[model samples]
Target: MFPSTEEGPEDDSAKHGGRVRTFPHERGNWATHVYLPYDAREEFMDLLDTLLFHAQTYVPRLVRMEAFHLSLSQSVVLRHHWIHPFVQALKDRMASCQRCVPRAPLCLSSPSPPRLPFLS
Candidate 1:
C-alpha cells in the first residue's frame, strides 16, 4: 500500500497508480468536506491513513485513533436545550453500527482523563 524505495518507481505501481500518487496533498481538501463522493474512497482512505499516521507519530499524547467516524460534543448552550435528542442520535448511530457490523474494529479515547498504559 506504500512505496518502497528499494523496489524503485519502475515497479508495477509506477505506471498504474493514479494522479494522487503524484500529489498526495490534493487529497487533504476532500477530507475537510462534510460529504465526499463514493468515487473518492481511495483518496479518503489515503487521507484518513495519513491523518492517523501523523496523530500517532507526532501527537502521541492524543492516543491517536484509527476509527474514522467522529461525533463532537454539543456546545454548552445547545447541550442544555437539546441534550436528550443529541444523545439519542448518537446512541442510534452507535446501535445501528453495532448491529450492522458486529465486532468491527474501532478506536475510542479520552484525552482529558488520560490513561497512561505504560505507567503500570
Candidate 2:
C-alpha cells in the first residue's frame, strides 16, 4: 500500500472570491497604486447608499467605502531603490495640478452585466 503525501498549506483562494494576485511576491519589490480622490456630494452619497443597500441583498457582507476614489493605475511592482524617486516625481507633478473634477457624468445604472468570464 502507498502512503499519502503531506500537504504544506491550505489553499484558500475562494476566501477572496477566487481573485488572483496580480504580482508575484519578491523581497525588495513593493506594490504601488496611484488613484484620484473622489469626494461624493450629498445627493450622490444618498444614491450610492441606496445602490449599496440594494446590492447587499446579493452580497450581504459588502460595506461602503469611507473614502471612495477611482484607481488611476494598477498594482505595479517597484524595486525598493526606486520608491523614493517615484514618490518625489509624483509629488512634484501633483503640486502644480488644479482640483480634478470628472468631466463626464456618472452612469448610475449598468447597461448590462460585464462579460468577465470569472464571474460566471
The models' CA-based lDDT, in order, is 0.40, 0.68
Q: After superposition, how far is residue 49 of candidate 2 from its true place, in Å?
A: 1.2
Stretches off by above 4 angstroms in model 1 are: 1-42, 63-74, 78-120
Clashes of 2: 0
As a TM-score, model 1 comes out at: 0.22
Candidate 1 versus truth, CA RMSD in Å, comes to: 20.1
Question: What TM-score do all the candidates reach, one by one?
Answer: 0.22, 0.58
RMSD of each: 20.1, 9.3
Could you tell me the lDDT of residue 101 within candidate 1? 34
- Give a tens-digit lDDT track for model 1, residues 33-107: 111122334666787778877877876644323344432321122324455664565556656543233255455
Model 2 lDDT per residue over 1-120, tens place: 232564334546677566566655665788777766778889889998999999999999777767877765556778999889888877777788787556787545422332212112
Model 1 lDDT vs. the true structure?
A: 0.40
